[model samples]
Target: MTRLNHQEKAKEFDKWISWKQEGNKDAETELIMRFLPLVTKVANRLAIGLPATVDKEDLISFGRFGLLDALQKFDHTRGLQFETYAMWRIRGAMIDGLRENDWIPRTVRDKAKKIEEAYTRLEQEKLRTPTDAEVCEYLGMTEKELQQVLYDTSLAAMVSIDEAVGEEDEQKTARHSYIVDEMTPRPESVAEAKSLKEVLSKCIDKLPEKERLVVSLFYFEELTLSEIADVMNLSPSRISQLHSKAIFRLRSALTRWKSQLL
Candidate 1:
């Protein structure tokens, strides 16, 4: 199948809008068929890292409603492209659907909002992308507290590109339409990382009950050594020693497993 350029798609969209305005049934079908892939694309982008129970098809269905709304409200003579307007509508619809379905928890959403605000403030103050330390300082959070916030925020956040702001021409075009580069670190590297994580999990499981608890609190729960020590009723130095020993065991196991795989 031949791919339509943005201009061609915009022209077709205008025709669909006219047909729908005239109450033509066939035009509605044509419009849906032409833009279904676009709906799916936006849905996929919004649903990244979401659970399997949230069906992609459901998001597309919701996006169709948004497309219909956009078609009805579109003013072609105003010099704005339909695709550009419809993209936001479609994305908003999908996100609204997820929100209605309770896919995001209130706590997670709050954290994401806080992180976004903190980032915005830091960017304004620094006039550049600030380091993680800068963010921690601005938020008045210790490193461990900051990491927990980041992890929670990531759990609920949707991946989106930077939208073109304040530029009519750029706003009318797809901001990130080009294919992303796929030549990242090798598969072997990813495999190695996965192997290391698995080995570390196993090593942690083998620790004495107190040590296991300490590791879980420090890594998975993002707690500080002092916090873990208080929870386990041990000295902070003892918790530190246990953490170092656990890491050493994990590294040794991973090294052995890697040699076998080779």
Candidate 2:
């Protein structure tokens, strides 16, 4: 199907939504067909750093539930675009499904926590982004051993930053209110979001050059860790270590910033 421009697409969607609201099965099917590409796009992007054992098709299958849920729950009256709302629902559903499956082993999660702890301690002590060598020394491991641990813990690290920090329902509601709002966001929420972006930018900018490049390529460029490894001429495991360390530093910085705000 040819893509419609925004105006044309919105009008078409309004028609389909109205028909579906009136129990039109054909309209519902059409909406599903139209959103399938979005489901696939989210799944593919998320699957990048996931372990090889995870099936991409499984993420897509999980994402369909999110799409349907978004279609049912989304309020056009809220003035939020379906695409924006559906993207979060889809990604959240996939992560929830992965958690349900307990895909990351307990040991890997422990190791990832240990790495984060090292980052926190070092940053508090030195007030700088610790180099990979420094982190390895802090962990009392060789560079090769650090790489192996990183490979084992990569999925755990990726999931932790986005994991809910409080009661599940409350976390979901807070995230939705913060990221997806009803028409215009409250001034306070807008200010909080701006502050968060500024803190995150400064933290990322302070990363070691190679680590910064890895973060840039993976998140901004949407490149896989292996692809970034190729670009940097390092092993994929090394790239994962850099990615993990970068996230740890950012999380620590953000935590400290939030504490200072209180």
Candidate 3:
């Protein structure tokens, strides 16, 4: 698509929206062409840290399909911006495509599950987040074995944040979308979210200093695991283990916090 000035693009968008709603297939195609760069941008962001075998082009292709889905389902009358809504669907689609391709091995998925279950169970029993040593004892694994499991499942963790919530329905929604909304939220929801944010902040602050640092660098600073490892003077695998442990703590805390809210 040719570049258009802001006013020209707005005018063109209005025309396209009218034609699209009137069932003009060409208008739809033009819209897709105009927004193709957005898909590429989202694809590149998601493609980070993926193995070389997972081609970036393939992710872009998958994201294009997602953008198409968003175009089909989007509601312009509701005041939701197309870019933001499409991003959610686009990322979800790319992740779903990866999943359909069996990007995570069954063994790795199983190990991730075991670790999450061990943490959940031990935390509930102990009435607090379990230590790495405690989790190792509960899972009958040496500290080394635990770290290996964490390393192997780290990619799966990267793909699936929903596992943190431990409910299928909740898992269907992105954790970020669930705990927060950038678009308009109802006034009551805003109040509830503010309170929840405070609770979450406290929970994060209470994490072991190392785990807190890992969470801060990864989520706040947007650092890759290897980058975090370099900063902490640890192996990437060790950082992955710490990342997994920290997630388990947050997941458990959030589950409890949500329950109380209900």
Could you say which candidate leads in lDDT? 2
The best-first sequence of candidates by lDDT reads: 2, 3, 1
User: Local error of candidate 1 at 200, Å?
Assistant: 40
The collision pairs in model 1 are none
For residue 261, model 3's alpha carbon misses the true position, in angstroms, by: 6.2
**Candidate 2 TM-score, true structure as reference:** 0.85
Better of 1 and 2 by TM-score: 2
Candidate-wise lDDT, in order: 0.57, 0.73, 0.70
- For model 2 the local lDDT of residue 98 reads 88
Query: What would the per-residue lDDT of candidate 2 be over residues 1-262, giving only the tens digit for each residue?
Result: 3567999878766766676567777777777788878888888767655777889898998999989988887765656567767877888788888888988888888898898888888888888777668889999999888878877777777676665423344224222222222322445455666666677778878888987898788767768766787899997767776777777777777678778887
Q: Which has the greatest TM-score?
A: 2
Candidate 3, after superposition: displacement of residue 49 in Å?
A: 6.0
- Candidate with more favorable, higher lDDT: 1 or 2: 2
Provide backbone clash counts, one per model: 0, 0, 0
The residue-by-residue lDDT of candidate 1 on 119-228, one tens digit each, is: 55655576554466776787788867765554444324342221221225323322122112111133534454455456556655765566577557754564655567
Worst 10 residues of 2 by lDDT: 174-183
Task: Supply candidate 3's per-residue lDDT for 98.
Answer: 85
For candidate 1, the per-residue lDDT at 155 reads 27
Off by over 4 Å in 1: 1-18, 49-54, 76-80, 117-130, 133-148, 155-262
